[model samples]
Target: MRILLIEDDPRLNEALCCALRQEGYEVDACLNGQEGLYYMETGTADLVLLDRMLPGLSGEELLQTRRKAGDTTPVLMLTAMGTLADRVTGLDLGADDYLVKPFAMEELMARIRSLSRRGGGFHVDSGELAWGDLTLAELSCQLRGPGGECTLSRRECGLLCALLRHPRQTLGRSQLLLSVWGPDTEVEDGNLDNYIFFLRKRLKSLNSRAAIQTVRGVGYRLTMQSEDSL
Candidate 1:
């Protein structure tokens, strides 16, 4: 699973990132609410770990903005404010769960699992995400089609998931980069191009009807059109 972590304290942020990574999750760590919001708006993270007190934009303001924009990615608010009213306010503002500071990692993991099972994030019940005849198994990163099935690397899986979520709609390069590689990563345009090439090869190998079409200077889209049309 991919998680966006927003914590201002340098030590806590680093520790959380390490722990989350050790748990086998892809994590994007941000020091402030503004950066966190930038990542959240990419519609990529499966979960968000938001700190209530942030440097630039407060966590409450960020959460409110996200909810107002209709982003349903599950948020677990982490804060030092342990009062009942604080918890109530966080929940009322759209947090799916609340964790007071100095909490155990075990409890945090438990809450994450619960939120994932509750299906508020990027999770799907069938363990598969489908577009046209293509179906990708989340756990194994396996892409199956009429011809056969092939396992994809983590990055490939992330890229394809973003496309499948909005099939046929153009996804900008920057959006794809942020979503797949984690926000604010310094990935090159050629890197994305290479991945696109790899994905096309996988589709061709499967003899799938779907294709990833490039939009010249714009970006790319998933389509069920013949290659000749491109």
Candidate 2:
């Protein structure tokens, strides 16, 4: 999943970004609240790690603005304020969860997993996503169909999951890139093509009727073959 981290301390911000990246998550980090607000407005991040204290705009203000605007993206407030009133205020301001400063990375990761599974736009109970006859085990990166099943690499699973989530709608290349690789990642355009090719092969191996159709000079969309084509 992609995460947006808004923290003012350069050291803490850098450390958190590195740790999140090492854990295989796409992370976009900013040192202040204004920039953080811009990143959140882009709607690229699946989860947010927001610091309560920030310059220009406070985390509480940012969260309040996002929530007021009806953005339901899950946010985990990271702050040094550990008092009960502080925790209640943050939660009341619309944070999905709160984490105080000097936290263990293990605990942070656990919270991220919980929030991602809870609000990452997938089927929470089943841990699976489906479109047409194709079913994807999100946790295992396994793709299953009427014909067969195959394990997908994490990247491939992410690419396919994005498509399955919005079947039949053309998604721009840039959008797909931001979805799979964070906005900060320096990935080549060809890398996306390679993953698309890999996903196509995975679908074919399962003999599924689904297809990832390219939209000439635009992007790609997922479609299912008609019975006559089968």
Candidate 3:
């Protein structure tokens, strides 16, 4: 699963990132809320660990913005304020769960598993992502189709998930880059093109009707191949 950690405490952020990575999850960590907001808005992360107190934009504001904009990615609020009103407020602002600071790592992991199974605001059932005849199993890092199934690299899985999340819509190049490679990473445009090429090949090999169509100067869209064609 892909997770975004938004926390200002440098030590905590590093520790959380390391722990999540060790647990076999792809993680992106940021020290400020602005960067966190940008990542969340990209609609890539399966889950978000948001610190209630942050630099630039507070976690509350970030959650509020995402909720207002119809972004349903699950958010778990982390803060030192362990009070009744605080927890209620966080949930009211669209937080799926709240963890008080100095929390047990075991509990955090448990919550993550629970939220992942429940899915984000998009209401993904279990941990499977599906489009057309293909299913991307999030935990196994495998793509399954009518022709067969194959394991996917981490980057390939990320790119595929981003596209599957928006099926028919045309995703712009920059948006795909930000969602898959992240905003801070410097990657060539050709890199994305290469992945798209490989993904198309995979679909063809599976004999699936789904195809990734290039939108000329725009980007790409996932659509079903017409049975009459070829």
* Residues 1-230 of candidate 1: C-alpha lDDT, one tens digit per residue: 89999999997787678656744589999999999999999988999999999987999999999999999999999999999999999999999999998775545755776788888636535657887889998667899998899999877877887788778889888667655664324677899899999999999899899999999888999999665753
| Alpha carbon lDDT of each predicted model | 0.84, 0.84, 0.82
lDDT of 3 by residue, 28-126 (tens): 899999999888878789899999999889999999999999888888999999999999999999999999877645457657877877845433345
- How do all models score by TM-score? 0.54, 0.57, 0.54
CA deviation > 4 Å runs, candidate 1 = 124-230
By summed lDDT, the worst window of 10 consecutive residues in model 1 runs over: 177-186
Off by over 4 Å in 3: 1-48, 51-124
In the order shown, what is each candidate's alpha-carbon RMSD? 11.3, 9.8, 11.6
Clashing residue pairs, candidate 2? none
Reference-based lDDT, residue 146, model 2: 84
Q: What's the lDDT for residue 148 in model 2? A: 87
- For candidate 3, which ten residues in a row score worst on lDDT? 119-128
Q: What is the model-wide C-alpha lDDT for candidate 3?
A: 0.82
